[model samples]
Target: MAHIHLGEGSFPLWALVLWTLLGVGLISAVVYRVRKGGIKTHQIALAGIGAAASFAIFQLNIPVWGGIHMNLTGLVGILAGPLLGALIALVVNIFSAALGHGAVGLLGANTLVNASEAIVAYYAFKTLMGMDWDVFPASASAATLGLSAGAFLMGAIIVISGVNGSALPRGDLTVAVAGLVGLNLGVAVIEGLLTGFIVQFLASVRPDLVGLTDRDTREETTGVTA
Candidate 1:
């Protein structure tokens, strides 16, 4: 929002397509690796933070356009890390498309931008949490940092798409770029807060929900204390 052109470099249609393909391919590889690592640890909820958490996120939304909306993807990323987060995104995006939030063509781009927020949230918070104090910094930091970056990523795509697409008007593109960014600021904050809260909650209530988080904790503790 601060600059109309700020996001103009990221979301061209072809670029989005490429990004989606790359993400799917990359995550697929990670998933394979994780599967080989061993079976899932029980007591860890896959939907994370838990279904209650997802339900909680569903309750929050920022209205945009005549038909669009935005909310936090922070929890998903935090729980899944990039790879699993992207997988969750793929499922959610599919459902959203069926419900008319977006078309199929743009699904990849959406996942690319938003899922990164989750991955960032997961790792950033997960790492900070290692310092102790009950995940205070992880909770406080992930949402703000991850969502801010996610907002920028999403904003970038909208601008680039306008430049690349034959169907979009130049003026409309600029307006959308600025408007979405401004609109996204509040949403990003909410996302960040939500991410932090959820991370802390799960870490306390059901830490196993975070597959990647637990693994890292084990590795760090083992490496340092050993």
Candidate 2:
């Protein structure tokens, strides 16, 4: 929900290069981990489906917070796992840029923003579930937390990069970005609820698809043994 809408040349050359390099590094690490760990066949299938869904949702522009949109990156991370989820973010941004939805130059910065959401959400959800929380509450809380993280990261990138050609001073820019971040938090609650319902429905019918079966089995076994 925190996609940057700035056009090309919005950031200075140094900022662009710096962000691009960082993004490349992140992707490279993810690729190496995926190769070393070897993804399961089901996870590969899930990644494909998550990529398609994430791309589709990325296109639906909701007219809020100066034209924001839902990315569903949290759900993608939850279903596809972090490594594949990060890849899905890259793929969705690439397609979006190709279609004129986002600027091609900011792909690196944007990828980092969306990827953080997925990564945080996946870990947060797992942690909450491990603490004996119910699926709906845990998933919903994790999704909200994930979106919030993306929103803050988006604000930080904008502030640090300092948009070129903008007349506002650094202090003013930080204030403005803070306002935008607040608006995004509001949007996150709505999107988070939507994600929660979708995940809960999937868990009800296909627990294995969401990686809930193993958790459930372990809990049941512990109860019997205890």
Candidate 3:
């Protein structure tokens, strides 16, 4: 939802370098964690499933104000967990760029934005679940938080890049950030509902996959102990 679809030259070289470094570091951490977890068959399958879902769903593109569209990144995170979620987001962004949904030059920044949303969504959901909350509401809140973070990151990037000018013109940057935040605040509700319902359904039926069942909880505890 907070994807930066700008073309080349959207960001200065320094900003690009910083974002690229952050993206690389995050991806590296994802790779390390995935490898440490031994890359289970279920994880691989879920990654493919989540990535496909994200790609297909992003095309829905409900035309919101300001050229922004609703996205299902939180749902992908709920399905794939953090590491696989970020990996799947990277795959989605790359494929989307190839398909002209975004620019190649913006891939690093977009990947970081999407991956942060996914990682936040995963952990937020897990934390809420640990607190004995109902799945739907918990998921909805987590999705909202995830999308909010992504939106804030997008605004920060724009501001730090001088709002595409020599300096961040205070008025223009304020208006731009206000618009971005307002649009995302509305879209976050849509995303949250979508994620909440889907996650609720999955938790009800395939609770093992979502770590919602007692058996899965016990195994998770045992793994931590081991």
Q: Which portions of model 2 show Cα errors greater than 4 Å?
A: 224-226
Tell me the tens digit of each residue's lDDT in model 3 across 92-159: 88998898887777787888988888888889998998887898999999998898888888777767
Better of 1 and 3 by TM-score: 3
Tell me the whole-model lDDT of each prediction, alpha carbons only.
0.58, 0.90, 0.81
- Candidate 1, residues 103-190: lDDT per residue as tens digits? 5666667666666766777777767766653464566577567666766876676666555434658777667666666666666665
lDDT of 3: 0.81
> How accurate locally is residue 216 in candidate 3, as Cα lDDT from 0 to 100?
65
Worst 10-residue lDDT window for candidate 2 reads 217-226
Global local distance difference test of model 1: 0.58
| Model 1 residue 45 lDDT score | 49
**Predicted candidate 3, C-alpha RMSD:** 4.4
Considering lDDT, where higher is better, how would the candidates rank from best to worst? 2, 3, 1
Clashes found in each candidate (C-alpha, N, C closer than 3 A): 6, 0, 0
* lDDT for residue 84 in candidate 2, whole number 0-100: 93
Judging by lDDT against the true structure, name the best candidate.
2
lDDT of 2: 0.90
